[model samples]
Target: MSRRHVPAVLALVAGALVAVPAQAAHAATVQVPCSVPDLVKAINTANGTPRADTIRLARGCTYKLRAPDPVNPGNGLPVITSEITIDGRGATIERDGQGGEVPRFRIIYVDKTGVLKLIRTTIRGGYATDCPAFPDAVGASCGGGISNNGKMRITHSKFTGNTSASPVFAQGGGIDSPGSAKSTISDTEVSGNHVVYTGQEPESGAAGGGISNDGPLTITDSKLSGNTATVTPDTRSTAFGAGIISFFGTTIKNTVISGNRAFAEKGTARAAVSNGIPADSGRLTVIGGAVRDNVSDAPGGVAQGGGIANNALMTVKGVKISGNRAVAKDGIARGGGVRVGPSGTLDLKESRITGNTVEAPGGTAQGAGIDNPDGGVLRAERNEILRNTATAENGTAQGGGLYHAAGLPASGTSTLKRNTITDNRAADGGGIFRASGGLTLNGDVVRENRPNNCAPTGTVPGCTG
Candidate 1:
C-alpha cells in the first residue's frame, strides 16, 4: 500500500476507462405489418428517444389510415420531432376515405425540430383540406402527402394522387416546406397531385401542385408530371406552378417537368414552374432539365408563361422548353415558353425554346417564344427561338419570336446574341417585337417569319427579312 503503488493503480484504472468505449446511441428498428397505430407508435417512440430510428415497411403492403382526426395538426401520425428514417421497401403509405371523401389530413408532418429521411417509398392519396383552421394566419394548406417544416431528404420515392384543397389557398399537393426548412429530393417522382382553391379571388388561389418550397430546396434526377393547380370560378386569382413553386431559391438538375397544368376558370394562371411570386425574393437555377408539354389556361382571364414564370432571378443552362401553351379565353396571353415579369431577370444559355404558342381569342397575344415584359431583363445566348406562335383571333398579336414590352416606370432590356429566330407567326413583329425597351440583336438571324421579320419600333440591329 505504498504511494507509488496507489499512483500506478490510478493510472491503470484511467487506462481501463479509456479502453472501454462510451455507450453508443441506441437505434431501434421497427419491422413489417405496421398498422396505422403501430407506425404512429414507432414515430412517437423515435421522437421521444435520443437517437435516430428506422421504420421498415413490408414489401408491397399498403398501410392505410382509415379514420384520422380531422382537426389535428398531424392526423395519421404524430408530429415528428427527432431524427427518423422510413425505408418503405417498395411499400405504400396512404390515407383512406371516410364515407366518400379522403381524409382531410396529411400523411406525415415533420415539426421544425425534426429531421426525416424517406427512401424507396410510395406516398399516395393524402388530402389536406380546410387545414390550419386559421388559414390566413398560417399562409399554407399544403403537403397532402408530406409536410416538412424542418429538414427532409427523400430518395427514390414516389408521390401520387395527393391533393391539397382549401377555400383560400392551397399549396404543395405532394410536399410542402415553408420557412427555414431544407429538403433534398433525388430520383423521385411526383405525379398526379392537385392543388385546388375554391376561393373567389385570384389572390386566394392555389400553387405548386407537385411541390411548394418557401425554403431552400434542391431536386435532382426527378420527374414532376401530371400535376395540376386549379382555381375554380377564378376571380383574378392566380393558379400557377403545377410542377413547382419556389418562394425561396431552388436548384434543379437532370429533372423533367412535363404534362402539368395551371388552369384558372376565370382569373390569371401562370407558369408550369414558377421561381417566385412578385412579392417574394427567390431564384431558380436549372441545369440540364426539360420543361415541356405544360399548359397554362385562364379560359375567362389571362394566361402567362406556360413553361416558366420568373418573377425573381432565373438562370437556365442546357434546358429544353417546348410544346407549352398559354391560352386565354377573354384576356391577354403571353409567353407560351417563358415569361420574365417586372423586376425579374433571366439568363438563358444553350436552350431550345420552340413550338410554344400563346392564343388570346378575344384579347392580345404577345411573346409566344419569350416575353420580357415591363422592366424585366433577359439575356439569351446560343438558343433557338423557332416555330412559335402568338395568335389573337380578334385583337392584336405581337412578337411571335420574342417580345420586349415597353418599360413603364422602369426600362426593360433584352439581348439576343447568336440566336436563330425563324418560322414564327404573329400579327405584328413576327420575328422580334420591341416596343419601348432596348432590344439588342447581335449575330442573330431573323428570317422566314410570317408578315415581317422585325417591327419598326425600337432599334434592333441585325434584324432582316
Candidate 2:
C-alpha cells in the first residue's frame, strides 16, 4: 500500500522537467551492457549528469536491476532529482539468488516525477524458497516487482511468480502506488503472483496474491487469475484486496477479474478480493468485465462483495457476478456474492447474481447471496438472481437468495423490480427477506423457493399448509 503523501518532493522533480538546461536536453541514449557491471556504470553516469538521460538496455539477458541505496542517504542523490528512462530491450530480468536476501531489486522505484515505461520484458521476483511467516502484514519490505509513486505506464508486459514478505505493516505486496500518483497499465498479464501472510493457524494470512492498489488506478485489457489472498488467525486483518484493491476513483474496464480466492479460518475476514473498491468513497465502475470463481473459507469466512465490496454509491451495469461462495458459523456473516454498506445504494441492472451460497452450521446467524439493508437500497432490474441457497443448520435463519436488514447509521431501502428470484431455500424468507422498511417488488417472480419455517405455527402458510 503506497499511501505516503509527498507532493512537495514530487513537485520539485516535476518543475525540473520544463527547462532541461541545453547541455542535458539532448537525446543522449546511453546503451548499458547486458550485465550488472555495465548497468551500474550507466547509472553512475546518469547520476553524475544534471539533465534528463535515457539508459537503453540491450536485447539480451540482465542478471539483475540495480538501484541507488535507499538507506545510504544521498548515495544516489544526483539521480533522485533527475529524469531518466530505463527501458528494457525485450530481455528477461531475473532476481539474484544468494542467502536469505531476495535475488533482484524492484524493477523500478520512482522518487521523482520521471516517466518510466516497461515494454516487451518479463521481470520475475527472486526465489527465496523460504515463505516468510506473514506476507500480508508486511508487504512493503518485499520488492521483487515494482513500486511507483510517479506517473508510469506498463504495456505488453508479463509479471509472474512474484512474492512479497511482511515488509512494512499492511503494504501492497506487488506494485504499490500511493499518493496522487497516476498509473495506467495496459495489455498486461499478471498471473501466479502471491502474497503469503502467516495466519494464527500457521498457514493463513491475506496477501494480495496478484496486485495491490492503494491509490487511484486504471486497468484495461488485463487478466488477474489464480491469485490467492489468505489470512491466518493470529493476524488482525489479513485480507483487504486479493486480486486488486482499488482505493478512490478506481476504474477497471474491459478487464477480467476471475479465479481469485480469499481464504479465511486461517484468519478472521476477507474484504474486497476481486474488486476491493471503497464503500463510502469515490466511484468504482466496472464496465464490460467478468468476476467469477472467487471463494472464501470458514470461521472468518468471506463477507460481502465477493465479486466486489462496494460500500459507496455503486452502479453496476453489464457485468456478471457468479460462482462465489461464503461460509461461516461461529458469529455473524452476510453477503455471499455482494454486500452493500451503510450510506451505500447499489443500482444493479442487466446483471446476474447466480450460483452463490451462504451456509452456517450449528450456529445462529443469517446468510444471503446478496445482503442489503433497508436503509441501503439494492435496486435490481432485468437481473436474474436464482439457484442461490442459504443454509442455517441447527439454528434459525433468514433470507437465502436475498436478505435485507436495516440498522445502519443512515436509513436503508431496497426497490427491486422486473427481476426473477427462484429456486432459493432458507429457514425464513427463502426467496426474499424483507426484515423491515420498504421491499418493493414489481413484476418479479418468487416461485419454487422454500421457506422452511414459513407462517410459523398458527399461520395459514405454515410449512406445507
Candidate 3:
C-alpha cells in the first residue's frame, strides 16, 4: 500500500488503456437495403462523419426513387456533401416511373464539396428536365442519372437509359460534370442515353447524350454506345456529341465509342464524339481507341463529322475510325470520319480512316475520310485513308479521302508523310483535295481513286496517280 503499489496500479491501468485501444478513425461501412430512403439515410449518416465511409447496397437489388422531393422537386436523393463511396455490388439505383406519371429528377447529385466514388453500380432511368433549378448550373437540363459538381470516380459502373429533356437547352444525358469538377471513368459502360430538345425557333438544343464534361475528364477501358442527341420539330436548334462532349478536354485510352447518333431534324447535327465544343483552350488525346459506326444526320439541315469532331488541339494515336456516316438533307455534309473545325489542329499517327461516307441530297459532300477546313491544320504520319465516299446526289462531291480547304491565308496547312490514300470515291479529287492550303505530302501514296487522285487534275507534289 505504498509508492510501489501505486506504481504497479498505474502501470496496470496504462496497460489496460493501451490494450483497449483509443477510438480509431476507421472507415465505416453501412449496409443499405433496397429502399431509396434507406440509402439516403445511410448517405446522410456517412456525410456526418469525417473519415471516408462506404455504403454498400444489397447485391442485385434495385433501389428505385418513386417521387421527387416535395420541397425540392426534381431531386431524388439528398445531396452528397462529403467524401463517400457507394458500392452498389452490381445493384441498381434507378428512377421508378418508367410508364407512369413521375416527376423528372436525377438519381444522384454530388455537391461542390462532395467526393463520390461509385463502384460496380448501375444508374438508370433518370430524366433531367430542368437545370437552373438545380445547383450544378450545367445548363437548362443535364446529368440525368448523376449530376456531379465535385470530384467523382466511377469504376466498373453502368449508366443506361437516362435522358436530358430540357426543351431549351440540355447536355449530358447520363452524367454531367461542369465547372471545375473532375471525373475519371474506368471499365465502365455508358449506353442508351439521350439528349433531346423539341422547342421552336431560336431555342437551341442538346449535346453529349452519354456524358458531358466541362471539366477535366479521363476515361479508360470504357465503352460508350447507342447514345443519341436529337433536336426535333424546331429547325433552329442543333445537336452534337451523341457519345460524349468534352468542353475542357478529355483523355481516353482503350475505349470504344460506337453506334451513337447526333441528329437534328432541321438544324446542324455534328460529331459522335465531340471534343472541345465549348472552347479552344482544351485538348483531346485518344490512345488506342476505336470510333466507328456513328451517324450525324440532319435530314432537314446540315450534318458534319459523323465520327469525331475536334475543335481544339487533338492528338490521336493508334486509333481506328470506320463506317461513320454524315448525311444531310439540303445542306453540306462533310467529314464522315473526322473533322477539324476552324482554328483547330489535329495530329494523327498510325490511324486508319476507312469506309466512311458523307451524303447530301442537293448540297455538297466533302472529305468523307478526313476534313480539315477553315483554318484547321492537320498533321498526319503513317496513316491510312481508304475507300471513303462523298456523294452529292445533285451537287458536287469532293475529296473522298482527304479535304484540305484553307479558308484564310496562312491559316490551314496539311503536312502528310508516309500515308496511304486509296480507292476513295467522289466526283472530283477522289483521293486528295487541296484548295488554298499549304499541302506538303512527303512519301505518301495517292492512287486508284474512282475519279482523279488530286484536285486541279494533275499529279500534285509528293503524290502519284
Displacement of the residue 297 alpha carbon in candidate 3, Å: 0.2
- Per-residue alpha-carbon lDDT of candidate 3 for residues 1-465, written as tens digits (9 for 90 to 100): 111111011100000001111223787898998877889789879877777789999999999888875544666877777788899999998888868877788888776667889999999999986552233433368789887766789999999999988745778899887635557999999999998875564537677899977667799999999999998654556788899877666799999999999988668888898765334336778899899999999876778799988777789999999999999877889899999887578899999999999998888898999988777889999999999999998887989998888776657888899999999989988998887768888999989997889996553686655
Which 10 consecutive positions of candidate 2 have the poorest summed lDDT? 6-15
Q: What's model 2's lDDT at 26?
A: 74
**Of candidates 3 and 2, the better by lDDT:** 3
Which regions of candidate 2 deviate over 4 angstroms? 1-33, 39-90, 97-105, 126-144, 196-207, 271-281, 298-302, 329-331, 364-368, 373-377, 395-397, 450-465
Count of backbone collisions within predicted model 1: 2
Candidate 1 global Cα RMSD: 12.7
TM-score, predicted candidate 2 vs. hidden true structure: 0.75
Model 2, C-alpha of 276: deviation from truth (Å) = 7.4
> Which ranges of candidate 1 are over 4 A from the true structure?
1-26, 69-74, 130-140, 179-181, 277-282
What is the C-alpha lDDT profile of model 1 across 1-465, one tens digit per residue? 111111011100000001111223887788857577777777778777777789898788888887664436445667767788899999999888647764467888776667788999999888875333223334347778887766789999999999888765778899886635557999999999999887553356677899987667899999999999988674667788899987677899999999999998678788889865323445689989899999999887888899998877889999999999999977888899999887678999999999999999888899999998778989999999999999988888999999897568858889888999999989999988887777788888889998789886445777765
Q: Which ranges in model 3 have alpha carbons more than 4 Å from their true place?
A: 1-25, 70-72, 132-139, 179-181, 277-281, 408-410
lDDT of each: 0.80, 0.56, 0.81
